[model samples]
Target chain A: MRGQKDIFIVADNIVSPLGGTTAENFSRLVAGITGVRRQDRPEMADQPFYAALFGSMDGEDLLTEDAAASHAAGGGFTVFERLLASSVADALHQAPGIHPADDRTILIVCSTKGNTHLLDIDDHTPAERISLPGSAAVVARHFGFTQTPIVVSNACISGLLGMITGMRLLRSGLFDNAVVTGADVITKFILSGFGSFQALSPGHCRPFDRDRDGINLGEGAGTMVLSTRREYRHGLRLRGGAVSNDANHISGPSRTGRELGDAIEVALREAGCGAAGVGFISAHGTATAYNDEMEAKAITLAGLNAAPVNSLKGYYGHTLGAAGLIESIVTLASMREGIVVPSAGFETNGVSAPLNICRSLLRGPLDTCLKTASGFGGCNAAVVLSK
Target chain B: MEYITGSCVIDGEGGYKNEKKIFSFAAGSSQPAGYLPALYQHFNWQYPKFFKMDNLSRLGFAAAELLLEGWETGAYQPQEVAVVLSNANSSLDTDYRYTQTTKDIPSPSVFVYTLPNIVTGEICIRHRFKGENAFFLSTGFDPALLTRYVGYLLEAGIARACITGWVEWLGEGFKAALFLIERKETAGAVPFTAGNMDRIFKISMPCE
Candidate 1:
C-alpha cells in the first residue's frame, strides 16, 4: 500500500468585492466590513436585493497590473472566466516555481453555473461556449495547462468537492500539484431563480442569528494551490475532507442533519484529530431557517458545538460555488494569524442547538480549523486544515 | 481494486441491464421527451417524484432503479454507498427550460434542477444511499477519470460501493450509462478498469 501523501496549501487568492489577494480580503474581514449591500437593479429584480457585487469592473479590474494590461486589449474572457483566470494567476504568482503548464500540475474548476448567463443574452450562442466544460477548457488553455481540467458542478459543494478531488488525485500519484478554483457570477438568471424559491434575504443575511431570514447571493472567485511539496508559507495542510448526501430532500436540508454530522465525524477521524483538538469551525451558515438550523444541529451532533464558530456569509454573502473556497481561504488565514474572525451577522442563538458563535474578533493561539459547506441537491462537505 | 458488478444503459432507443435487453422503444416512438416516462412505466416503478424530475434526473433515476434492482437488498449500508456521476453538458436541458421560465415568473421547480448533481441527489433520495456524492462535467465520457476517482474512493475506504457513470441530457439527446461498483468480485463481474469500462460503454451504446 502506498503511504498517504501530505497535501499543503502553497498559495491562495480571493477576488471578491472585499479585495483581490487573500491578505487584503482577510484584513477587510478582520475590520468587520461587509461587501453585501442593497442593489436596485431592475434587470436583476423588480425589488432591491442585498448582494456583494463588484463595483463596475467585475473581475477584470481585479487583475494584476500585468494581466490588466493584456486584458485591456480585448482579453475576450467572459466575466466568469476572467474571475477564475485572474484568481489562479494571482495564486500562481505567489509561488513562481509552480508552473501552470507543468505536467505534474492539474487544474480543477468548480462552479454551480458557468457561462449560464450567456444564455440570457440570446439564443444564438453556441452550446459549447455555454457549457461548463467549454469554460474549463478555456481557462485551462489560458494558462497553457497540459492536462485536461476537471470541472466540478455539484451545486454549492462544487468548490470543496473540487479540493477533495484534487487531494485524492494527488495522493493517487496522478499529479503533484493541483490548482483548484471556484467561481460563480450573479446574474438575472440566478437572482430570479433564488427569488422564485423565496430563499433570498431582503436585507443583509443574519446567519445563525435569531433574526436570520434568507441568503444574500454574492459574485466572486477563489483559488487555492495545493501541492505535495511543503515549500510554501503558513504550512497549512489539507488534513482530511469528506462529502455526503442527506437522501431526504433535493432542495431542503435534512431535518436531523445526521448525514452532515457523519461527514464531519469521518473528516475529523481521517484527519487523526479529535473534537477537542479543533480550535474553530467555519460553518456554512447560509442564513436560511432550515439550513442554519440543520448546520447547528450537525455541529452539535458532531460534539463540536463548543468550538468557536463563524460564518463568512455575513462578510461575503453566499458566493455559491465560491463560498467554500473563499471561506476556506479566510479560515486558513485566521488559523495562521491566530485570529478568530467574528460571525458578522450572528448575535443571538437562532437554532435549537447551543453553539459558541463568535461575535467579536479574538487573538489566540490556533492550530487547527474546520470548514464545512452544504448546498442544493442535499450535498454536504467538510475539510480539516491545520497549521 | 473495485469491480463492476452491475450496469444499466439508457438511450433514445431503449434501455439495457447487464447486457440484457430489458426494454426497447417502439419504431419511431417518442424520440426524447417521452421516452423516460415510457421507460418508467415499462419498469412498473411507482415513484410520483418521477414526474417532478427534470429530464436529467428522470433519466438518471430510472437508470439507477434498473441498475440497483436486485442489488438493493442490503449488500451495503445506506451510508456506505456513494454516487459519483459526470456529464458533458451540466443540466443544459433543465437550464433551457428554466431559462424560458425566467422570461416570466421563473418556476421554482424548474429552477431547482439547473445544477447537474441534482440527479445524484434524486437517486440518493429515492434509494436512501446517503454516502458521498459528486457530479463532474467533462468534455466527453472520460472513462479514465471516472475509473481513477472511484478507485481512490474505494481504496480509501470512503465507500464500499459506488454508483458512478455518465448521465447526460441536452436538447433531444440523452444517454445514461451507470455502473454499480464494489470491492468483492462476483461471478460474471468484470474488473473495473478504464479499458473495460470504455469497452462496456461502447458496446452498451453501439450507435455512439
Candidate 2:
C-alpha cells in the first residue's frame, strides 16, 4: 500500500461537550472528563433506570439560524451536519492552502445516521426525511465541491472506511486532495432502537471493565484533510488500511478472531511494519459484553499484547459511525503530543489476555499507532498511521 | 474501469427463466416485482426448510449464487470473495417489524437483523467468505463511486473477485442486480462501461 500524500491534519476540531477542538477534547480526556449524563427527555423522565449519554456541543458556536434555515428550506440538516461543517471549516482553516471548491479536491463524508434526526419530524416522507444523499449534497454544496462526493454509511466503520475511500480516490488520480469527515448526532430513534436491542448501558460506559454492562450512545464529528504527498506536509501519514468481514455472525462477534486479526495483519504488512513497530492501539471498545472480548482476542491474535491500548468510550461514550474517525483523531493527537491517554473507567480487567490498558496518561515519543474498529454485520477495519 | 465479466438478475420468475425476458419498471413505485419469484426460487436451494426469509437475505443469497456459478471453488476460495453492496431504505421491513415487537416484547433475533449491513454478513456466512467487505448506503445509484470502490478492492488485492450491486427490498417491491468483477491484464470483453449498464438495464436477452 502507498503512504498517504503529504497531506497532514494541520488542524483538527470537535464539538463534543468535552470541548470544541483537539486540544480541548484531549485535555478533558486526559483529565478523565466524562460527558455522559442522565436522560432529560420528557418521555424518558419516568425511566430513571435508563440514562442517555450525549456529547453535547455548543450549537450557537457551530451553527447559525440562517444556515440552519437554508438547510431547513430542504427540511433542514440535522445537528450532525452542523457539527460536521464546523469541523470541516476548522480543518480547512488549519490547512490554509487547501480549498474545498478546488476541482482537484474531493469530499468524503461518513455517518451512520446522516440526517436521521429528520426522521423524527413528521412533515416529510421517509425518503425525504432520512435522505443521506441529500445530506451529502448539502455538504458538497457547502464546500463547493463540484466533483462527485462520496458518502459511506457503514455502521461503526463508516469513518475509517471513509478515510480509506479518500485515500483510494487520491491514489487513483480521481482527485489531488480529499476531505474526509464523520459525524452523527443522538436521536430518539437511535436511542429507542438500541434500547430495544438492550444494548445501552445503564450509566457511564466502562470499556473492558469486568463489570462492563453495555455501550452508552454519544454523538460528535471529526474531519481530516488529505492530499497527495506532493501537495501537503506536517500531517500524520496514513500508511495502510484493511477491511474484512467475520462471516460468522451479524450482531455477535467471531470468537476465533481469525477474520478480524487478518485485517490488522494485512494493514501492518501493507505498511511494511510488524506488530512490534506499533507503539499503541486505539481499540473499538464499545463497553459491550461481546465487542470488548472480541477486540481483546483480535489484539492478541495480532501479537500486540505488549503495545499499550485504550478505548475512548469512557471519554465520549460510543459515538457510533463517528467513533472511528473521532478516536483516530485522538490517536493522532496522542502521537503528536507524545502522550497516550488512559482507557478511562477501566478499573478491572475482565478478559483473559493481559492488555496494556493505559491506566493513566503515559508521556513519551511515539511513532506508529493502530486504530481498529468493529461494527454490526461482522464488519471490521484497521488502519495504521505513522507520525 | 473494471469489467462486469458476469451479470445476472432474478426477479419474480425463476433463475434465468424469466419468460417475459424483459424487466419491468412502473411509474408509481421504485420496485417492480417481476423478479421476486425467480429470486425466491433460486434462494429456495439453501432455505428450503424455513417458512419465510427476509428480503435482504433472499436477495443477497440469490445474487451471490448466480455470480458464483461454474466458478471453481478451490481457485476462488470463499475467503477470497467479497461482497460490496449499496441500498437506500436499509432493512426497513425488518426495522418496522422490530419496532412493532418493541411495543409488546422485543425479540432479540428480530432486532439483530435491523442494521443494513447484516445482509452482507449473511451473504458472507452463507458462502464462508472472509475477505474485505463493505456496504455503502446511498439514496440512489452512483456508478462512479461504485466503480471507484470496486477498483480499489481489486488493486488492494484484498479480494480476487467481488460481487457488487444494489439490493433494496421494501414493502412488496424489491430490486437486486449484481455483477461479478475480476481484474484483467489487457482490454477484454464485458467492459463495465455505461453501454454495458444500459444493456443490462434496458435491453433484453434471449433465453438459452
Candidate 3:
C-alpha cells in the first residue's frame, strides 16, 4: 500500500557467514572480506564447490551451541530453523515492545524450500514437518507468537516480497508490527538443480564483472521488525515497494528488462521520491551474465544510472532467502555511515548497458536508497528506504 | 471495493464452470494427466506450451482458460491485474519427481517446475498480467487473509483487478478454485468478501 502511516524498520539482524549479527556482517564487509569459500561436500558432488556455508564446525556448531542454551525448554529445530529463530530473537531483543504475544504483531516467514532438504529418502521426519508452512509454524510456536504466521515462497525475491508484504500489513492497520524473516539452507537438491541449469559458479562470483561466471549459492537468515511504532529515533522507514511479473518466461528473465524497470518506477513513485533522490541503488546482481545485464538495463531505464550501484553477492555469495535483507541491512549501514560499500568483486564493466559500478568505497551524503531483486519465475520486487 | 466476476473448478473427475460440470472423464479412470490432454482436445484449445507444463501448471492454466471462456478481454488492463495464489503443498509433487532425476543428472525441465509459483508465471505469460503477484503457503485456505491482502492492493492503487486462486496438485486428489476479481462495479458483480469466498468454496460437488 502507498501508506500514509509511517512504517519504520526498527530492528534488523543478519545471521550469516559474515557474522551472527548485522553489525558484525557490516564491519566484515567494510574490511573487504567475503564469506564465499570452497567446500568439499561429497553429498552434493564429487568436486568442491564455492559457496557461503556455516557447517557444524568441529562437531559443535555455533547455531546448535546457542540453540541448546537459548531453547533449552524445547528443541526439535533444524539448522535453518535455528538460524531463523536466532535472527528474529535478536530483532525482538532490540525492539522489546513488539513482543510475539502482542495482538498487533504478525509473523511473516519468507523462504523458498524451507525444509525441503530434509526430505531425503532416508530422513524419518514426517513429511508435513518439513513443509515450508509447517516449519514456519514450528518456529513461530517456539517463539510464542500468538497469531498464525504467513509464508511467502516466490523464488529468490521471497525476502523482498515478504518485506513488502509486512509493510502492507502495517499500512492496512491490521498489524502495528510485523516480524519478517526468511532463511533457506543449501542442499544437494538445490545445488544439483542449479547445476542442471548450469547456473552455479565454481569460483568467487564477481557481480557486474567481465569475468563473472554464475551464482555461488549460500544459506542464512535475515529478519527485520517493521512497525508504525517508532522503536528507534534514527530508524529507516519503508517508503515504497512493489512486485511485478515479467510475463515473458517461467524461468528465463525478460530480455528487455522493461518489466523490472516498471516495478522500480512504481516503487519510487509510491515513495514520493524521484529517481534523482535515490543516493544509491542496491541492485540484484546475481553475477550471472543475463541477470546482471537485465538489472543494469532496468536501472538505466529507470533513469537511475548515475547513482552508485553495488551488489553484496560478492561478499555473501547469493544467500537465497537472506540476500535481499542482508544486502538491504548492509546498504542501510553504508548509508548511515555516509560511505557506499564497494562492489566487492568487480573488475570491469560487464553488461551491455553502462552502470556506475562502485569499484571502491565512496563517501557522500546518502539518503533515500532503492533496492531491487529479481528471481526465477519472472518475479521482481523493489523497495525504497528513506532515512 | 472489488467484485468476483467469474469462477472455475476442477477435481478428480472432470472440469466445471461455476460449479457446473461441463464434462466428465471416460468410465473408471482417475488419471488427470491422461484426461487433461483429451479434455484440451475436446475444447479444441491450442497452446503447445500446455503439454510442456507440469501437472500443477496444467491444472492452473486449464482452470484459467475455462474461467475466461466468455470473459470480455477489455474489462481491465493486463498490467493492472494481480495474481494471488496459495496452496498447502509447495510443489512437493514436482520436487519428488525432480529428486528422482537428481540421482543421475537433474533435468532442468523438471527442476524448473519445482517452484509452486511457476504456474502463476505460466498463467501470466499466457494472459500478459504484469501486475503485483504473490504465492503464499499456508496450512489451508484463509479467506480472511486473502480478503485483507487483496483489499490492500486495491486500496493502495497497486492493482485494479486480481485473479486469486487456491490450487493443489497432489497426484490422487487435486483441487483448483480460480476467481477473477475486479474492483469496478458491474451488473452481476458480487462483493469480494470473505463470506462470499467461504460460501463459494463450500459448494457441494455431486461427484467428489
Please write out the lDDT profile of model 1 over residues B61-146, one tens digit for every residue: 99999999888548788899999999998988888889898887799999999999999999999999999998989988989999
Q: Per-residue lDDT for B142 in model 2?
A: 52
**How well does each candidate superpose onto the true structure, as a TM-score?**
0.97, 0.89, 0.96
Per-model DockQ: 0.81, 0.52, 0.74
Query: Taking the tens digit of each residue's C-alpha lDDT, what string does model 2 give over B164-208?
Result: 877778767566667777775233337766455535533234444
Give candidate 1's root-mean-square deviation (CA, Å).
1.6
Candidates arranged by lDDT, highest first = 1, 3, 2
lDDT of 2 at A72: 55
Model 1 chain B worst lDDT run, 10 consecutive residues: B199-208
Q: DockQ score for model 2, please?
A: 0.52
Best by lDDT: 1
Candidate 1 lDDT tens digits, A1-387? 236888999989999999999999999998889999899878677888899998853454666665565467775677788888889889989978888789999999999998877877787787888888888887888788999999999999888999999989988899999999999999888989998999999898999999999999998999999999756644789888999999999999999999999999998988888999999999999999999999999999999999999888988989999899999999888987889888888878989997999989989988988899998999999999988
Query: lDDT per prediction?
Result: 0.89, 0.73, 0.84
Report residue A315 deviation for candidate 1 (angstroms). Answer: 1.1
> Where does candidate 2 chain B have its weakest 10-residue lDDT segment?
B13-22
